[model samples]
Target: MNQTSTECVRVDINVFPTAPPPPPPVVGPIPEKLLKIMRKYKYNWRLDQLSKPKHLEKKFIAEVVEPLKIVKVKLPKLDPEKEYYADQQSIPLIRWLVINKKLYGKQNGKKYRKTINRYINKGWGSIYNFYKKRERDRRLRQRKREAKKEKRMPDFERFTKLAIPKRLFKPQSPTKKSPAKIFSNFDRLDVLATPKPFVEEPVKRLGVNPAALTYEPTETVIRLAQIPARLKNLPKPLEPGKVQKSALRYKVTPRIETLAVPKQRNEKAKVDEDYDPWTIPPNVLKYKATPRILELAKPTERS
Candidate 1:
């Protein structure tokens, strides 16, 4: 028996519907009308329009409506339920706010929320407590080190008190000498010796001639007369000059004529041929002139 074959065709439909084209591209929280108002107003837009409530409605419209009418291009979408954390950018902003109070409200509210969340995660109370404990421990450690240093120092007064008593009170006193033994021998010698009685002899006068012995004068008495009267006196008179006429006559003569004969000219004395006064330099003859010659050569006319 020949049977006719019928081919079956399989149609595969994607169960997820291609994820609905990623729910269109999330356009913006800022709408066209809001953007126009923002452009007109510059930075003075209403806070409620820029807030979370308006952003949620705008996000829904962008997620649902924008891509369906277009070429169905998928773009990145932000989750409405999850928080957008900008902690990296917000930390410097928070630090700036803490340093400058004027920037406290001027910062973006979202950035402030992210910074507050980060600080909460890092535990602000724990950081403050750690610094406080560190300072306290440092002070305690410093005090303990100072106490130890003081304990190591010597107490000079206590050392002095212990030393003085040991040095002053250790030795015994020396024994005294016996006075009775030293004086016993001296007493016996004084009792044994007796003093002799003094004897009296008669003094007699003998007669002698007065001329039997001749008196002699001492040599020292004769030398007394030889001493000069001027030497005995404290001061003496000056003597008058006794001039010798012969000596005065001798000194008045020229020294060369009185003391020596004149030197005679010999055959060896020669006349100098070069002794021309005009040829001689004036400076060479300065010491050769007599005083009388110098006076005679003076100018007759006064200047």
Candidate 2:
């Protein structure tokens, strides 16, 4: 037999174009002032790696530390009397700082976890308590406003009101002790005239009107009224033979036959009773889990 030989074949494919060269790193040496601030305020970690330049490849001096410097410079100028207000003002800045630190940690392969946690635990000061106080104050102001609105004066009365002065009354007057001689209402005054006899007026109503007594006809009554009172000719009675023929013509037809077989005596009644339309057939159905359905179908896992 001829000697068998194997040779490797080479193939080259330029399906994907070569990617462009990466931009040069914009990194610079960490400033002494930035390092000092970081040490003082505890802004970031990996200070030990400052001497080892490789670990400080992605220094977050501009993104993270610069804002802290600005805040430090402005802190003294802000009024200390409104300390809470100043703190509230710094909320957005602190939140942004924390978020940037987290992003930086992620960029450095999560090596600076303490930096993120420190900012979250230390830098974010009493934010939840501050919001709670604000909400409480808002509710109190709302209640005060509602009460003030309630206490507001109403519109002036339409009728003329006279303010009777106490000076108009005479002290220890004989007329004040005596009963009034004049009666304002004539109906209540006693007179020498005899009582008049009751007389019925023709214009005055004695009973309810006939039209008012009667109710308006309903739709059913109006529709029934349109029908003739009497028929010109009465309908003939149905014959027994014709009625029988009509019943036979309209009788329901027999059910169509089905090819389905009846259950055998050997088969269990549960087979037909438990049949679900939604269930997949056993022949083609698949269970893509460990221990199939037996373990999963249980209410609690086997001990």
Candidate 3:
């Protein structure tokens, strides 16, 4: 049996592969939503990855940076959960990349990363230099904007010149007026009589002498005097949105009554009124049994 053989023929066509749709123009103004996110994070680009060049190339280094702390933020828009724990001190760029990944996938995330990189690579050498220069440029831009706005505004002078009256311009003759009238009754006359000298006189009083009079404070006055002390002990108002700490509660214990006994003393023995403890022998002093030491030592040994 003869086997039929088939050979495939190669054909060449002049057709060229189309280029990708320009990568969606990465070099353009960042989205307002992204800028809002940056503002929330205070435009903090100080990240571990941003600090080192080796970390820049690593795709997963900036994936999940450890935050300074985790805080629960309230989100009213979400249906089920009212609040969610969010990372603090996290890089805004990383958050954008994450959001893009979840919403648009890896390609969009890469584009966002490139945009952030472009912004970061603006100034001379490092991220710090870039941020400094960016801040200076922003200040300069704000100043220029203010200057332009002032230039556009109409000149509103606070004190404007008033029009001179036509009557004042015309020459007028000076007129003479009669002298002011002087009344003899209105004249200030010097007092010819001098004031009488002060004289001491006997004061008449009803039975009680003025020197013996005393003042007694009323109940209201006493209460007013205690107001300052009462105010010091008053409970302070609780801070807004803060729970006041509960006051400590002490447990009450029953009091045990004990029979009182008279202290014992030897009357016959010649008691030394001047027994110098400092001059006593060292051995005796060291082993001396005092009431306080005996009382304290009672709890040491178990019966």
Candidate 4:
């Protein structure tokens, strides 16, 4: 009533205040006795020297310390044939083709996909993951090599192999084999695909002997003479001579594996003795370093 027109002032209030964080929780002070004991022991406190260290328990050593101990475990031998990657350098098929002037002088996404797919059957998986795993393996190998190098004698030759030349990795042209040709399409027409008999054959049911279906026992226990007719289909007993001598059969011949083909397989045989068709093909590299007699007539000797 004194002001007749009283002005109302609106004040903006903040729900959350932005301020520096409160100090961290105060840790309880170390016991004066514990502090004195720690000071006496010093930083280099030898637990083993202690008569009865509280932390050094038998259970602690067995359960915790033993497992925590560092061990140099021997790695299993890796087979190059099994562990070897075809594309270790991680070169993309199209990229390789381009570099080598292959791919029929074409550069496109479709061609790239097709080229990549060609090597997929040969165990090419996700390129990204493959390279990642390869890098990880390479790092581990490097670490092992470094450790070995440190421990090795100065006079002894280190296992430092000569680096492979980039030219050696020249991508060989993919063989002129097509997927369509590899997997020939053909419908299976075999009627005996399933166990179901043909229209002409009788429907066979699996159960007790077929003879039992028609059997009609004349008495509670049939005479032993009738046993022969009842057990006609039963297997015959072994004869004295035909009986097995030992648990393991001696006549069995273990498989003899021939690793390499015959060296002189392709050599011309006498006219009387024709070449064996089933013989393994000759190795061209068998006489790689050795010189052979010339079959062609010499220029000087020829009339």
- Full-model lDDT for every candidate: 0.59, 0.61, 0.58, 0.57
Clashes of each: 0, 0, 0, 0
On TM-score, the leading prediction is: 3
lDDT of 4 by residue, 234-300 (tens): 6566565675656355544344234343445444563538667666556844644423334333333
Top candidate by lDDT: 2
Clashes of 1: 0
TM-score of 2: 0.15
Candidate 4 Cα RMSD (Å): 51.7
Candidate 4 collision pairs: none
Model 4 TM-score, 2 decimals: 0.12
- Candidate 1 has a TM-score of 0.12
Tens digits of per-residue lDDT for model 3 on 157-231? Answer: 632333444455667789889899977753335443556689998777668876657767789989877858756
lDDT of 1 at 116: 59
Rank list by lDDT: 2, 1, 3, 4
**What is the alpha-carbon lDDT for the whole of candidate 2?**
0.61
Clashes of 2: 0
Candidate 1 vs candidate 4, lDDT winner:
1
- How much lDDT does candidate 4 score? 0.57
Q: Write the per-residue lDDT of candidate 1 for residues 1-303, one digit (tens) a residue.
A: 336866778999877633222223336696788678656764442443356363344343544545445467787776653323433333343344454434553565767756655654443234334576577679999999999987999788888988785445768789787676445586667767756678886666466645655656589878875867777775444335865556578655587676678545444443655444346666877868889999999977522
Clashes by residue pair, model 1: none
